[model samples]
Target: MPVYEFRCQACQRKSSFFVRSIGGSLSPACTACGSREMSRVISGFAYHKSMATIHEESGGPDRPGSDYYKDPRNIGRWTEKKFKDLGMEMPSQIQEMIQSAREGEMPESVKDLQPNLTDV
Candidate 1:
């Protein structure tokens, strides 16, 4: 089961519910205001660990005491593998985007939105 977050428009309260399927519709009622007008928000998952944490927890990979850094190709490989696992075709644009990121060149689409990291 997956958890989904929802915000009540009437009372402005947020709640989370475990949903069996992503396609299922949720009740719009607000727990506080009893209003049937609520909006769904992106929910966070608590049960899973991130890739970096998983790597660290596994004793830094096969070589003991060696720092375990993710392979630069891992992202592209994972992206391709995920599509294969889902029985879906990988889009060429996504492949290109991963390639560009690996090459350290920001994609033209998001170039203008780059943040100024020097600014605190």
Candidate 2:
């Protein structure tokens, strides 16, 4: 089996499709918008790392968009983008987090959590 990446023009979301055969009769639809019009996209590979390196190639903390995530608004956008990229439904917990950030408030549970001694 092989996985293929596709971008939907309508929703501007990307998703992966696992296929048993390439030549067989099969069509892919956008998981988010249910649009059949999609284009193949080149997928990037990811790897696990023990530590992040400050380099352009590795996309570390020093990367251009890294600072964008620090903003609460951008954090919500990033979360939506991530969910769209993975073709996964945004979970309720994540939705609440984004909503709270957009509203300039932290979730009550996160705000009320007391730091453990071990964390310090």
Candidate 3:
């Protein structure tokens, strides 16, 4: 499916329409104003990253930097990876907590888990 955005002539608001096929017809009306006069908008584009590229960007599990934990992308990454590495399914409760953390609300119990170290 492809998404086509349009600018409404009457309300000047933007509306997007999802087409099932590239060659299919899409008559997009302004969802806000219900106007049929829409001008096709040239949407900005983006590309996806492969697993290798993503792993490389995060500095991988074995070599995470001091600031790696600060990255929002790594929010619940370690817990998920640890479960996968152990060949275990993450519990639904833990999965919910991780998802919530990723969505921006940190679980009170899991906050401020900075590592503690001593000269050994």
Q: Pick by TM-score: which candidate is best?
A: 3
Local accuracy of candidate 1 as per-residue lDDT tens digits, 1-120: 666667888888987677777787667566677877778886554244345556566442233222222343333554566578889997888778767756765566533232232441
- Candidate 3 stretches with Cα past 4 Å from truth are 1-57, 112-120
Give me the runs in candidate 1 sitting further than 4 Å from their true place. 45-120
Residue by residue across 1-120, what tens digits does model 2's lDDT show? 556788998998998887688788658899999999999886752112222332443342223344544455544554466578889998988778767766787665533332232432
Clash count for candidate 3 is: 0
**After superposition, which runs of candidate 2 have C-alpha atoms over 4 Å from their true positions?**
46-120
Candidate 2 TM-score to native? 0.36
Lowest summed lDDT window (length 10), candidate 3:
111-120
Per-model TM against the reference: 0.36, 0.36, 0.44
Model 2 has an lDDT value of 0.62
Number of the predicted model whose lDDT against the real structure is largest:
3
Model 1 error, position 65 (Å): 21
Residue pairs with colliding backbones in model 3 are none
